[model samples]
Target: MGTKKYRRDTLIEAGLLFSLFYLPGYLFLAGIPDPRSFNSLLYNLQIWILLVPQIFMVIYLMHRDDLLDFQSFGLVRPGAKDIPFILLAAAGTAAVVMAVQVTIMLVAGEVLPEEPLWKLTKYSMIAPVFISSLLTGYSEELFFRSYLYTRLEVLDTEKWSRLIFVNILFAAGHLYEGVPGGFNAFILGCYFSFLFTRKKNIHIPAILHGLYNFSALLLTLFL
Candidate 1:
């Protein structure tokens, strides 16, 4: 009876997270006429506003459930032993993202346009880039890998279904980057999810995520 109740509760929590958190953002992006043309600063600010509340909500929910510990979220303090793995994952992810863009450019026979995020590099706008990247990185890892994934596990969700559900939403969120970007995100999601499942640690992927976004913004400064 307790087992059944736990399963039911986990299912409810998973449903709520998907509906309240992921679906809204996906729908918002889908509803946008031209997200590319949207004001970068405004977009950055809007994201920060959205993410702050969402992060707090995650914290609140986890605390309420007494699942607020770092391990519960698949997070841990990085040690020297973990540095190489994190670096390798970050590099691999970066390579894959670049490879996709390069392949698309070569096939299209034209240079790809600048990323919308690159617009945030102006000194005055720079802070948002770092903050948003950091927030997005940890928040996404927390939500997808630690929270939703664990909830689904408790509910005995099918392995394939869990993978597809978590990754599709993640990839969908990157659709503003266009098809190539979405595809790239899906590939990275698989890697991060697998890593989290294997190591029970979210910091590697989270740090890599932030670094990837930070590097993108930093590129704008150099170029």
Candidate 2:
């Protein structure tokens, strides 16, 4: 039946999205260098190369599943009012996350690492982080929350189930950051998911994501 077929297709698409995002982190954990390392240049380049092909593959898969809508993937233009708020929220969220990170390090008596904090100060590093953040945040949101959540919504699924599923996958994708980072990412994913569900706009969440990364970049520089 068409109903059963639709359900099957939805499951497959969700699975693919989850795997595309998380598998790289798993590989990285198997032994990727810290982004602050001298060899981080080579490490980041390899990850970017791997990411591009997966991106195209996800796009194709989403298109095939009929979930590739403009708004869902953030292709829709943002309004002027949306821009300012998004930027402000992004900045605030980034600041808060950095504060928390610092507090944690202070409490643990772990002195901040001396290496260059941002990979973007160098040309080779800039390309990967910028492209990776934009693409990964935009595309992943489209696949996980926008496309997948929309389908789940139509299916009359429970709200909590939707939130948990999407958040878990989102967190799982950051597992390469280690257990602490993974836990933090998972918690943040839940917060962002709530924001998305309430606002029904990807700009807010995307800006928040960018802000978080930008904050981390600054912390590396000044901490």
Among these predicted structures, which one has the highest TM-score?
Answer: 1
Worst 10 residues of 1 by lDDT: 30-39
Candidate 2 contains a number of clashing pairs equal to 0
After superposition, the stretches of candidate 2 with alpha carbons farther than 4 Å from their true spots are 27-32, 37-48, 56-69, 72-75, 95-128
Model 2 lDDT, full chain set: 0.62
> What is the TM-score of candidate 1?
0.79
Predicted structure 1: lDDT: 0.73
> Per-residue lDDT tens digits of candidate 2, residues 1-223?
2377777877776777666666655655545455564225566566567666765665565466553464544435678878776766666565556665676576655434344333434545554565556655665666666666766775668999988877786777665555556656766777677667766787677657755665556445444
| Model 2 poorest 10 in a row by lDDT | 111-120
